[model samples]
Target chain A: MTDADLSRFSINQETVKQWSLPELVEGCGKAGVARVGLWRAPVQEYGVERAARLVREAGLTVTSLCRGGFLTASEPGARAAALDDNRAAIDEAAALATPTLVLVSGGLPAGDRDLRGARERVADALAELAPYARERGVRLAIEPLHPMFASDRCVVSTLGQALDLAERFPVEEVGVVVDTYHVWWDDTAAARIARAGAAGPGGGRIAAFQLADWVTPLPAGVLLGRGQLGDGSVDLRRFRELVDAAGYDGPVEVEIFNEGLWARDGAEVLAEVVERYAAHAL
Target chain B: MTDADLSRFSINQETVKQWSLPELVEGCGKAGVARVGLWRAPVQEYGVERAARLVREAGLTVTSLCRGGFLTASEPGARAAALDDNRAAIDEAAALATPTLVLVSGGLPAGDRDLRGARERVADALAELAPYARERGVRLAIEPLHPMFASDRCVVSTLGQALDLAERFPVEEVGVVVDTYHVWWDDTAAARIARAGAAGPGGGRIAAFQLADWVTPLPAGVLLGRGQLGDGSVDLRRFRELVDAAGYDGPVEVEIFNEGLWARDGAEVLAEVVERYAAHAL
Candidate 1:
């Protein structure tokens, strides 16, 4: 990639949920972006196989697939369905030639206050699916969501806890995502990131590194307020240095979920993301 | 204190911010709540000295003072003002016969992103105030707010961080507050609380224990969404047991900030709070 192209930068489509698959591929291609992050629903809507081919034809790489692991359902049928969906996700990741399949460990089961138990369910699901993912040459990347989402979105709330669950399997099969937004508040984050990426029995390793800022007065639901890089309190350059020090030289995906960004022109958002990634995270 | 009085129960004034000092003292005393938590703003408005006298005459114990320590202000003058305010808080707590003065470490100063630096400023302020609090027979208790408030309310966002800062001073001089609403999502919380209260150099000792439940769909600005005892996902009984196991047989203050409850009759809110605390926490 050219110095200005930032070959390591990947724009997560959710940053501009306004863009369609073909539109995203075209936009990234014209902007000289080498990579784009994909989400399951939209990729499946465009037909995973066709979508994969479209990006491939455009010479754009899929840095990582959006999600897979909401496997905390208590009902036997629901749990099986979650696993089946995860398996399909693995297949899609393989098709897209993306190495990492991000897992947002689902929230506690309905009416369930057992956060520990729900977290264990994530481990169980990972154990059952690791081999499948390993065989497909894909790694299941456990994304420890911010604690705000601990109750209703993801039970995994810390990098260390995510590492504990991811380390139950071979490092090549399972790993952790080090998103600056979710983890900047964690005091132990820098050290834990080092340990996770270190070579040892407990090495879960950094599977993906996404960038987003932490802003205040989070909107209702607190889901769509992820700040664009350099817009909030996160020290993006420091995090970049940490991941790089941990030996992760993969794509640094920009995966924001902000209402303001989504409302802007998709090309404008992509351009701004590119510029910010270069100025703040690269 | 009667056998079934749950004598350790204290209600933070903010739970019913509507109640005047006289109203709260009368209400809490009649409801068999032997102790009550007070905020500086309302106390000052009601005349701090007079408010203290009212609670004392009502035979109510002041468990802890609401807050002090917004030491993250960037301007040098503002920082001095925060320290001065904290010193005044210590005097107020002493006057009210409260042993603990909770400190909500302020968020980042405007246009500032140096979180580590801001956190260090809290440590510095505590060092400056701990001795003053000790002389007044009041312990400076650092309250670790939830990570969601890291940018706007408190830079100290984890129980461990508070303990680390508090442990720097004499155990009796400095301590940490174990507020369930703020720390419930921390995986290391139970262990940290134990460490804080344990008898050793690292033993920061629990200065206060407050309760609130974790609820979702946080309101706009996310300030007043604190759940009442049984209305949210927190297993209050479990936290009550954790603190008890840590040998903290002190006031278990019920603090919540829900708009729904705040809009209701103060008496009805206190009644439900008592009922919920008895059933869900005590």
Candidate 2:
């Protein structure tokens, strides 16, 4: 396939986690993949400026930064620390020249059963950081993880809920991430995708569109079990069509976290992803 | 606590799976828990009639039968077999004198991506079984398993979706199950619980209410990670209050499937469940 065929394609760093920052840039450059989604840890490890320069010089675009939210911490000191860390993440995303900072809103605090309250804390955190992110020319993308992670990873478990929170702020400053693996199960996702795509006062609420398949017999912890494209039940093309209909023209980032994918050669995995995106997600 | 305190409490058989029919009946009798929810497999293995007689002799009530759905088969032979098996389950539920039969609507057929099609098949199966269930004096309670199981265990992954399916039939013929473990993470659960509790054309649509806590680091397979009451993030007492407010005075069944709980002495587990229920779920 020509590069034009994969124009919107972006490789999320976690999908080929075995590759270092330099290897990732080199790999994507060789594969004709123009975009990459970087995780904060690896970027921080490589020195954000150095990693940014590496991708920039290699003619690769940073589509989005991995994450910046864990705002469910309610204790005074912990809340401050979370917000501070998120600010740092936004700075890193800005330095990397990425437009989006993906946020997995944290889950309930220890022994806390107040899901609504935890979610409110997320909204509060967003209010505190939205301005900082806006000033940095970075948009914060709220990602509603699958409901299974509601208790431990993110209380935002549906696209509708993410929209609810995102609508409270300017669409340019705050938006939602539609990760197929997380929302493909919900019947309301299509409508919500449309809503996020629809132009609001600021712009489209849709910031980042991610792709990962949902395979069965989820591995332990359920965190690293994301299936490779075409390996699970999600209809990736339908999601792409829905997002396209909703007016989103951003990078389509493949972000699988399967152990099996990680053990393979990074370039080989990237090649297969390119082929699979053409086969299953075009 | 007095027997009056646990008057609404029901021990789901799977909670103490190590116990046989006789042990379960005796344990419930001694523990002052007057009702028990049962699984079809163990009941059939123990002989439905004999098991029914044993519970009757022990003066214990059978609150509900474990399951009767998986109605997502597409092939004609498999669909017919699924209907026949559900009819058999209805017969067993009737024999056991339980008014409710929990249904876990099956996931998508293997290699299929049409989730809406799979869901429609569940509706068709319900239509086929509803009349039979009504005639047998059993209500098919559609249990929306957690979204994590959307691809393998159940496609109805939200209370709202379950109600949409259940509302299609006469409330007496079909209803929705509000299992806290599966729905606690949902922001709309409280409102949906009210809808399920509201008096519709055929009375309240809530056929059964089950309880299990949401624990972390979900085990491999993610099926048996249900935590003991009060050991996880669910607001159990709030769920009870919501169900109660919705005018559902039916049994509040505690169903857990943790390996730790299963490995413990059945009596000790039962006793601990009673105490935890009193402390957290009452």
Candidate 3:
């Protein structure tokens, strides 16, 4: 890795899902970002093999896959299918040469009042996939979403919660994706980051660092409107400093999902993301 | 307290601010609610003495005063005014015989980056007001708003955070107000409630237990839109059970601030609140 590699950043494709894979690659290349994180739906839409080749051919690194872990369903058969899908996602991440596969722990099983039990199912699902991912040289990055999404999205809602789950597997095979949008509001964010950096109860692992700004008065269905870097209240420089302090020198990927950004030209969005990463992040 | 007391829930005035004080009182009385939480602005607007008399004449308990604490400003003049206003609010709470004066710890001071500094300022401000409140026989309940409001509204964002602040003052003078809307998503909510109940850290010191539903797709300016019980995702019964387990047998106040509820007749809103509290919150 060169000096360029040290400052490497990626534009998560969700930031411009409206664009095609080739267009995203061209835009990221023009923006001087050496990497990009892709979502599975778009990969499937473009054909996984072709998508992987396009990323490689564009001379861009596929930093990580956007997701793969909704393994908490009411039926065992559905859960099994999700695991199978995740196994396939892991293979895709490996083929794309990305080192980590982001895992979004799914929500409550129907008719189940036990949130903790649902969380346990996520762990069981991860454990089943850990060996296969490790064999393929891909790490699982459990991304704990905002607590607001605890019901219908992710039961794991804190970095500490994700770290606790990650403790069940080997550090190299299982770590966490620290997304600022989801965890910035947490009182124990710094402590949890430090813990994730340390030799975990599971293993010393800090696999990925994802970034997005925190905006106030979060609009409903908050899965969208992720503010562009430096556009919202979160202090990205401080976040970068915290991540550096945590002893993790991983890629700082910009993973925003804003309607405003999406509506713009993909190249323009990528260019703005790169400039913000340079100006606002260390 | 009669078995009737068990059915007596309070509607925070903000829940039906569109209603006049006398109208709210009449509505609460009609709904069989034992109490109502009043705000300083509304009390002042309605005439404090007249509001108190109306509440009394209507046979309603002033469960608490809605607020009095933005003591984390950078200017001494503003801080002094906050203190003076809090003192006046205490007098009003005393006039209504309301037991608790709710305190919302203000956000970071202008030009100040230290969250800990702002928190300390809140503690100092509380210390200054504790004696006056004790003399008035009014308890100050520090209400920790959710962390999304940490920068602009309140720095105190967790029950544990509020409890830590409460420990700085005497148990009789200062305590925490646990609102389900603010703390329902906390990972350690049950443990924190149990800890608050353990009295002085080890056992029962929760000063107030307030109820509201946690609705999803939270709208902008999230200070509003608190769901009525059972209308949203929160498990009010679990909360009640936790508080009961923590040894708090206080009145379970029903506080909803939904636009839908607000547009309805105050009496109908109050009636629905009581019905929901009984059916869903126990």
Worst ten in a row by lDDT for model 1 chain A: A196-205
Model 2, B18: alpha-carbon shift in Å?
0.3
Best by TM-score: 2
Q: Which candidate gets the maximum lDDT versus the true structure?
A: 2
Error of 1 at A62 (Å): 0.4
Candidate 1: tens digits of C-alpha lDDT, residues A171-231:
8999999999999988899998998869443233799999999997899999988999988
Query: Candidates sorted by lDDT, descending order?
Result: 2, 1, 3
Q: In candidate 3 chain A, where is summed lDDT lowest over 10 consecutive residues?
A: A1-10
Estimate, for each residue in B187-265, the C-alpha lDDT of model 3 and write its tens digit: 7989988878877542356767789887666676666757888877678889889988888876677777788887887
Off by over 4 Å in 3: A1-6, A109-113, A200-203, B1-8, B109-114, B200-204
**Per-residue lDDT of candidate 3, residues A165-226 (tens digit):** 99888788899988888877676888888888885432256777888987655666667757
Best by DockQ: 2
Order the candidates by TM-score, highest first — what do you get? 2, 1, 3
Off by over 4 Å in 1: A1-5, A200-204, B1-4, B200-204
Tens-digit lDDT track of model 2 for B3-92: 448888899999999999999998888788899999999999999999999999888999999899999999999999999999999999
Is 1 or 2 the stronger prediction by DockQ?
A: 2
Q: Please give the TM-score of chain B in predicted model 2.
A: 0.97
lDDT of 3 at B142: 93
